[model samples]
Target: MYHVVVALDEDADRARRQSRAVADLPQAAREVRATLLHVFTDGEGASATEVGAVRRASDVLNNAGVDVEVIERSGEPAATVLDVADRVDADCICVGGRRRSPAGKAIFGSVSQSVILQADRPVLVTGGFEE
Candidate 1:
């Protein structure tokens, strides 16, 4: 199976885009296993499956016949995502990219950028839907 760690955030659009990218993979139903990961920065005890963005992404992947699992964690987003991806031995890490200025990224730090740069495996970055 081609295992993937899909890092999701509160942005429903970004989640949808990330899910589509995975679902569109070759033989997704037969070969892809997606782990939907959500990191809670705030100390909320909410389940990952309960998050709106995660639910929407799960629906999309389910409709496309991809095997899915949901995991929730509390920590720094990028670091948590990387640690989970490593633990899962993911073949790829999927993340949604937000448009940010270089300076903005420099100051705020980009999760997608961090994952891309740090992951030992391939990273797939899906852009937010253009309106």
Candidate 2:
């Protein structure tokens, strides 16, 4: 079976998009095992909203008859995601992307960009989302 690690953020829309992307993957029913991962950079545990979003994502995969696991990690977003991917031996990493101006990106780094550039495994990015 193919293992997929989906990086879930606090943004509900983005998190849902990431889950939808995983659901849309080929062989999702028969060959996909998904882990919904939320990384808390502050070392704090998941907030109520975060846990709800994770549970919602988990439900999506579970309803599709896919084995799902929800994991929470504490560390830098990109680094922690990579660490989890390595530990899980993920076949691909799924993340949501946001459009950012050059100036904005210069000021704030992007976790999706970092994962795409630095990941040893394949990374699938979902973007162009409304809301």
Candidate 3:
């Protein structure tokens, strides 16, 4: 089975989309195991809302019969994601890139962009949430 890390931020809809993207990966020959990851930068534990988001994504993947593990970390989002990927030996990283203009991204930075640039493994980026 292949292991994948789903980067879930505060956006619940985006998190769901990322989870669905992982679950939709071709499972014809081998099963896909998913690690639902959320990072709390303050080194605090996950908040209730964050936990709820994880649960929502977990439910989607679990209901699809995909092996799922929920992981919460304390650190910078992109760096922690890469760290977790290494620890989990992830085959790929899945994340949602919220809509942002070139100027905005340049000024504010982007976790998705950082992961795509630095990740040693494949990174799957989904567009922002849909209605």
Candidate 4:
């Protein structure tokens, strides 16, 4: 049994995609536990908007019967997710990815890539339904 940390974003659609992806993972049912991680995603202050997103995600996962937990911290997005992974001793991390054209990747860089480089554990990448 290993810990799996999922990178949850502020978007409701993205979070739902992530939840379904986690449910489909081959290891999801076999794993001892799953941690549905979402960072504050703000620099410092806790915005009421962020609070709502977190609650929305928490409720979604909980209703799905996920062995899930929410992690809220103010920091860099990728850094916060990686920090949570370390804290939970996650064996693997999963994150939602948007469609990135080659040029787009060159310009904006990839959030999933950042987490992969920053985290000690293996990272899984998934795209939303439209992506």
lDDT of 1 by residue, 1-131 (tens): 99999999988889999999999999999999999999998798889888999999999999999999999999999999999999999999999988877788789888888889988999999875432
- What lDDT would each prediction earn against the true structure? 0.93, 0.85, 0.84, 0.70
* Comparing 2 and 3 on TM-score, the stronger one: 2
User: Which candidate number would show the highest TM-score if scored against the true structure?
Assistant: 1
- Show the colliding residue pairs in model 1: none
Instruction: Please give me the total number of clashing residue pairs in predicted model 1.
Output: 0
Over 4 Å off in model 2, which ranges? 47-50
lDDT of 3 by residue, 60-103 (tens): 88878899888788879999999999998999999897888878
Question: Against the true structure, candidate 1 has what lDDT?
Answer: 0.93
- Better by lDDT, candidate 4 or 2: 2
- The superposed Cα distance between candidate 3 and the true structure at residue 47, in angstroms, equals 5.6
* TM-score between model 2 and native: 0.91
**Model 3, runs deviating above 4 Å:** 28-30, 47-50, 129-131
The residue pairs found clashing in candidate 2 are none
Name the candidate, 3 or 4, with the larger TM-score value: 3
The lowest-lDDT stretch of 10 consecutive residues in candidate 1 is 122-131
Give the range where candidate 4 is weakest over 10 consecutive residues by summed lDDT: 40-49
Best by lDDT: 1
